[model samples]
Target: MKANRFVTVLIVLVFLVGGLFAQGQVERKAVEVKVLAGVTGGKDDTENALFEKEMEKATGLNITWEKPPSGYDQVLMQKLGAGEVYDLLYLNQFQMYALANQGALTDLTSRIAASSVYSENVDPDELAKIQMNGKYYAGFNKLEVFPLVNVNKAITDKVGINLNTLNTLEDYYQMLKKVKNYMENTVGRKPYYPFFTYMPDIWDLQPWFSSAGVRRGVFKDASGKKYAPFVQAQAKPVWEWLAKLYREGLMDPASFTGKTGDMRNKMWQSQEIVMDVDWAAWTGLYNNNAMTAGTYPHTVNVVGLPGTKSPSGTFMLEQGGASLWAIPANAKHPDEAFKIIEYMATKEGGLLLSAGIEGYDYVIQDGKLAFTEVGLAHAKDHGAPFPISTQFDLGVLGTMNPGVLESVAIGKRADVEVAPMGYADGELDARKYYDIMSKWMTDCIMGKMSADAAMRGAENELRINSLID
Candidate 1:
């Protein structure tokens, strides 16, 4: 009787285990999610096929990537305007802001608040940048400062200029003047390369004026009025300062243009430019090139060219994210959409998206993120494992090309200015704003119109549009 009872008990236990295993195998419906992927050079369907397949397997979600041929902002705006809102929308702050006010995207305040992934993984400072009116509408991108002053020490020695004496606009002018004279006298009229390059865009010009405490896009004045630098009273002196450099033949008028490779060739390739205010990634790359080719004798020295003497510690990347992903108010499968986001915040999703399939695409080398033979080959064919959907892996960045970290110039307040909370009132037109400002800037710098004239005209336009007062 004891033997019979024990056998029966064992059989019951096996049945219970079988039932639990079968329950776990219940298949979930594969949710089809349409996403506007603006971050990746997701240039073509073929380019992202492998990535899409990998993501689908990893997340148990189907995704369709809609990539615009060109002009990401314009394309995203167009889709929203035409009432073709996709399930997932990825956009920069301005683009997101434009739609966010219209009640288009979902308010993710509560969602992020409840999410353990957001609270635990995401940095507090990063979370702060993505908030509007104390609510998070989008996920924050990792912030990185690229305000660098890469000076060729060899050239500076030849010109008899010391970077240690650099302070205020007057000091900067002297440095440029010394270099300008050296180039003309020693090298002849090849071209005067003043370390000039704008990252992200020409509009994000913080490296040049941050020291004097000027923020790009929108900064606050002494009166606490939020305004763009071009229209601000404080910016006048800075403009005058730059104008002085231009007029003195230290700054080349021809260098300021839409053309590419003009500044790079002079600064990096030709080795003619003396001082460059740019990002570390490019500077580090240049350093590598110089080292390899024996072109530049000395390493490109880092310059602290922030306008103010107080030194604003390390400058923050104000607009760090390209576009914060948002779900449209008129979306189906909202649950699935949130699921995707939640999964993305997980370590599994982050690795899959950033480094690709570990054994297949990448592998750990010395406990650091390293690409395998497979990853290198794929990178050569397609773009490397840059997960545009998220911040890739912060860990990978620590092990990344080392140029990115070396490019960071601490103690410079790049574009330190004040900006009032929220968007400019009324319908915001980014195209008109950028167009007018770009032309005005080039005009002012190139001498087509005076800075005062350009500012006055721009102020009137911004005021009319209710962008500023």
Candidate 2:
């Protein structure tokens, strides 16, 4: 009887231990990953909360997202400076390069190599573009796109100018002049500025530089020496051309001091400007906004221009910087955080990021995705308008706002060369380069200095600041 009691007691102990082991496994599986995201899933707290729930369900892990709507760059620096720990953080390509140089980010080189999700979804060439000094410190959030010329075709039609024929610098100049004349005289709209280019950082001047056979940003010669193309003699004519536009009242004075928000408002809402340079994705947005305002397709029809031809006969368009997600060096759950990043590069994750929550933003009907009323209103983009996954099919998302497809298609043209701005290799200080160049460019365009003087002043400042040479 004692033997029987001893055996029963041993069996009871075994069962109890097994139950506890299973409970421990469950607890370990429920790890909560904290993220300080700046690029995606931070627009609305309620929406982000739902997004978090969806991400949690997909990854089988708990997630905490802290996304501040404004001043994200400053906030990111402050958080890292304070030694705050987060499993994941969102950053642009430049920020990734800067942080990687500082050793503040985890070296993701091996992690990405081992991840089958990355291999299957992201292109190797794409990864190569974002590498910092031969090592990857972050994963891509979205495919980088280029900004192109967006013109109000309705106004162009009124001027009797065909957008397809606009290939040379003189062509655009005459077109802008005609647009100004027609809008002021026929439409009776006073102060009808025809062209708008944001002078802050001298944004969207790539096309004009291409016309002079000069690519903007820092470049290396065959001898491995660095040089900036814009401050050089070849870029003089483009600078002079811009100053001429400002002098002629064809360019808005606001371009010298106004923000991008102000530019957008002038383009779409008030229709004060007939032409401006903007992102390809914004082609659809401009039309979508006009559609909401009940003036689309006829009164506010917008079209994308592949920009003026270079001397080599190719249109050089500058691609925007990549948006990335990185793991901080001090992150507690890097493995789980990388899992989330990997998921974002997957087809399923791409759908979530682009199309938004399934039930709330869309519904699957008859084995196909159908956008709900909310989804239609949502405009089919939560964060990434264009997903980074190679395996992802955007056709499943259905049609986008009008003009978007055409605008995006410009980069795919046979004669177009889409490249990123200089300092893309991340060896130079891009911020300093932009500030000095913009200041001088603004001084020249606003008639404070001659174009030659501006270029000389810029070259001197860039050399002194160690941005060039």
> Which candidate wins on lDDT?
2
Please report, in order, the local distance difference test score of every candidate based on alpha carbons. 0.58, 0.87
Task: Return the TM-score for candidate 1, rounded to 2 decimals.
Answer: 0.74
Query: lDDT score, residue 10, model 1?
Result: 97
lDDT of 2: 0.87
lDDT of 2 by residue, 1-469 (tens): 9999999999999999999999997787468798888757734777789889888999988888788778999998898888888899999888887888788899999999999999999978678778776889999888778899999998899789999999988899999999899889999998888889998877899977888778777776767667899999988988998998999999999998899988888888888998889999888889989999998877888899988899899999888988999998988899999999998999888888889998888899997889988777767777787888988887888877889889988987889888778773677788788899999999998889999999999999988976777
The root-mean-square deviation over C-alpha atoms between each candidate and the true structure, in angstroms, is: 10.5, 6.4
- Once fitted onto the true fold, the runs of candidate 2 whose alpha carbons sit more than 4 angstroms away are 1-30, 220-224, 373-377
lDDT string, candidate 1, 1-469, tens digits: 9999999999999999998877665432235677776654222455467666766676677776566667887887777788784777766777667667878878888888888767666656556666765776666332333444566666777677776666566777778777777777787855674645432245435544555555556543467465666567766666666666667666645456634356555665666566656544555556655655566456343233333332464332223333356778776666666666665555555565445555556677798667776665444112223332233454562353324343433422344322222233323455666666666666666567788987787788767765665
Best by TM-score: 2
